[model samples]
Target: MVAMAKKISKTVLSRTDHLLEVRDFVSEAARQFGFSEEDVANIVLAVDEACTNIIKHAYQYAPDKEINIAIVRNNGTFEVKIKDNGKNFNPDALKRPDLQRNLTHHRRGGLGVYLMRKLMDKVEYNFEAGHSNEVSLVKYLSKKQSLIKK
Candidate 1:
């Protein structure tokens, strides 16, 4: 059976405190979209990392700006987009940390981006229209497992 499409979107202040809300929203969206707990957890982690990155690096902990989040589900796939109006960053410019040499003394900055890429099935970034930056993450749900059975 083909699954239905669903979407949820929200904008919140770019602050560390709102990170929890971001996580909760992702978990609830996953549940509403019939994602298993394990899947939900993975999605939440990826979303959290993205959100935290925005809070720490994008807005630089400045509560003045806002971060936008959009969650979309289609054909048993989930896509989460996090956007901010901060300085633009070229996603391609990010070099993967040398795991062998940087694993021990690696700073905190690059780990989140690395983890988000590793955990999510697809990750992309966009910088356009002056200063808008958007990061998108995608996850494909397993057909064999469903959080809600109708």
Candidate 2:
């Protein structure tokens, strides 16, 4: 039998101030899905990075814009979909940062996208015409990462 998936969603202004609230929502959702503290932290960070990019890069700090986040968890995987209307991004066009070069040059950006890719099992992007740019991230839980009571 397949386990049921739980879903939660929230829409907030494209403002940096709302990051903490988004983190809180992620934490609560992860906890309910029986994720370990470490897993929750990773999920929260990845989502935060995605949201930060949306607020700063996509929306360009446009206060009137909004970001929508949808989180869903099924049997062994958790996923988050962040959608925005301000602008579209091509995730496939992004390249992984060279750690040595970036660290040596003290580069500030690209790290978030790298970390998001490393920490999550999957990361994808989709653009809907005249609708939204959606970035989706998924993480699979190992036995050790799950907090579910057997």
Best by lDDT: 2
In the range 1-150, model 1's lDDT, one tens digit per residue, is: 655447779999988788898889889888777777887888899888887888777778888899999988886788999999987766566688677657677654476788888888899998888788999999887766543444
For each of the candidates, give the backbone clash count. 0, 0
Model 2 error, position 73 (Å): 2.0
Off by over 4 Å in 1: 1-5, 99-106, 146-150
Q: Give model 2's TM-score versus the native structure.
A: 0.85
Please write out the lDDT profile of model 2 over residues 1-150, one tens digit for every residue: 656458879999999999999999888888777777888899999999999988877888888788999988887788999999977766567678788887899876677788899878899988888558999999887886564545
Cα lDDT listed for each candidate: 0.82, 0.85
Residue 146, candidate 1: alpha-carbon lDDT: 45
Candidate 1: residue 68 lDDT (0-100): 92
Candidate 1: count the clashes: 0
